[model samples]
Structures are given as C-alpha cells and as structure tokens.
Target: MSLPKVRSTTVLGVFHNGEVALGADGQASMGNTIAKSNVKKIRKLQDGKIVTGFAGSTADAFTLLEKFEEKLGAYAHNMKRAAIELAKDWRKDRYLHKLEAMMVVANKSELLIISGTGDVLEPDMGIAAIGSGSMYAQAAATALKKHAPHLSAEEIVREGLNIAADICVFTNHNLIVEKPV
Candidate 1:
C-alpha cells in the first residue's frame, strides 16, 4: 500500500452584501484516518486586502499560497492578475506542475478560484468552493444566499461550511474564516 498523504478538505468563499468572506474546515486527513485537526486553511493576504482559502495536500497548498503571494507582490496587489499569473506558473513550472491544490481568493468585489490546471475562474454566482466537501458547501451557500438575505458573507460561509462538515467525512467543525478589511 502507498503511504498516506495528508490533505485538507472543505473550503468556501462567499461574496454578499458588498462583503467577501472565505472559510475552511481544519481537518487534515491521511488516507482513511484523520491526521490532524484545527489546521488553519484560511489566510489574509496582501496585508489584509485579500482573503484566501486553500484545499488539498497541506504542504502543496502552502507552497501554492506562497507562490500566489509572490505573484500578488509582483502584480501590485491586483488579485486577478496575481491569480492568473499563479495559475499560469503552476501549470507550466516543472516543480509546481506536480502540486495538487486549489485556492479560493477574494477581495471586496471579486471572488476567484484557482487551480493547478491553469484555471482562474470567477464564480458567476458570487460563491466559490474547493476540495472534497466543495459541492456540499456550495449547495448550502447557494440556498442560504437565496433564502436568507440577511445573512452576511461570513455567516453564509460559516453555516455552509458547517453543513459540509456534517456531510463530508473529510471535513470537520474547526473552521478558520477570514474577510478582507
């Protein structure tokens, strides 16, 4: 059998009411076992102007985040430019090309999902999610956005992630949420 690799799952980002919030569950899994809990997968980048959530192999995700930050700096903090540049490099760079990770990044007005396959997508519905529990969290966020108009972006992310944690065995309740301020 192959050795187990630790990976993180369940990340959600919601843009609502002129605010953007990104969140992620804290469970890291190794094959069928939980390797760690309370691993923060959300961060504020560009000196708090952008919020980011990551999912996939823990070390690979960190590597991607660091590369993304470098792109942000090189691009003068333009999130779109940075994300696209990161995705471009992630796809072509021999080293980065081997990484397995995805990221949801946002500023107050824009939300984007970046993948190693050179995709930098802006969710038309103002929500983006990645990792194993993404679909569950995405569905939950969609319903909440439609029916619970009063909920803030962070609220939607929290509730949606919680719902995902309930449904996805790889996900958990320990969450880290961040918003650009």
Candidate 2:
C-alpha cells in the first residue's frame, strides 16, 4: 500500500532574549480538499517545559513524538541530547527511518530541528520553521529578529505565522502559541 504525502501545515519556533516560543497554524489538507481547519501541529511535552511542533502526516508525526519523548526521558530531559538521539535513531532504525515527519523541538534555552535523515539543526539566528510555508515564516521571523529586536518571542512567532498564512494557502492565522512558564 502506498501512503499519501501530507503537507498541510506550518510550524514556527523562535528563541529571543532568553525566551522561547512556538506557533503553528490550524489547517490540515487532504490532497486538494481541506480536511480539517483546527488541527494543532504544536504540542507541549515533558510537563510543558519542552515544546514540539511537527509537519507531515499527523499519524506519523505523532509516532515520532512518542519516540522523541522516550528519548527525552532516557537523556534525562536534556532537549538537545534527546533531539540528537532521536535523529540518530530515526535515520538508522529500519522502521523509524521510514517515518515521514519533520520536527522542531525546543525549550526556554534551546531550539533544534530533528529530521528523518539523521539531521539535528540549531538555527544560528534563533529561529526555525517547517512545512509548506516554512520559508515564508522563517524569513519573517528572521527579519523580525534582525530589524525589530524589541518584539517578544511570542510576538515574533505570531507575526511570522500571520505572514505565512497570508501567502501559503495551507496555513492560516489561527495560531496556538506556547512559551515557557
């Protein structure tokens, strides 16, 4: 059986002035049809200290999320280490290597992207985005960080999402924002 490729959302993460925040749109598309409008792509994990956002098949993303959480616990809640470990496993493990999802995992102190190809990335400018509208959102956040450094982390990401939603039909302005408390 062949699985459909799902690219229906946008997720953005930003780290600024010692704070971290993530925002994701609420749109899920199935082929040429809109499947759902309020689907949440960002999630809080490890008692809300850790944040994760995903783009791809929802079911596959959830599977990766569960594995990533296990890695977190094994690595003692160290976000970076857990991300790296997950990437390693995702690329090397037969079953995991086939999972179709990309993830951004972050905390108040760090931001990283875990990919199925065994890549774990930390954005130099403290911003990262994924999914179909990722480029638009990333560019917006990068500009905000460079030109308007006074904006809070939440504001930067929210504005980024807004911009992405405007240009990317798969994305929307209905954003869920989360920050470290």
The candidate maximizing TM-score is 1
What residue pairs are clashing in model 2? none
Model 2 TM-score is: 0.95
lDDT of 2 by residue, 47-112 (tens): 899889999988889999999999989999888988998898898999988888899988889999
Would you estimate the TM-scores of all the predictions?
Answer: 0.97, 0.95
**Residue 118, candidate 1: C-alpha displacement in angstroms:** 0.4
Candidate 1 stretches with Cα past 4 Å from truth are none
lDDT of each: 0.93, 0.90
lDDT of 2 at 168: 93
**lDDT of predicted model 2:** 0.90
Best by lDDT: 1
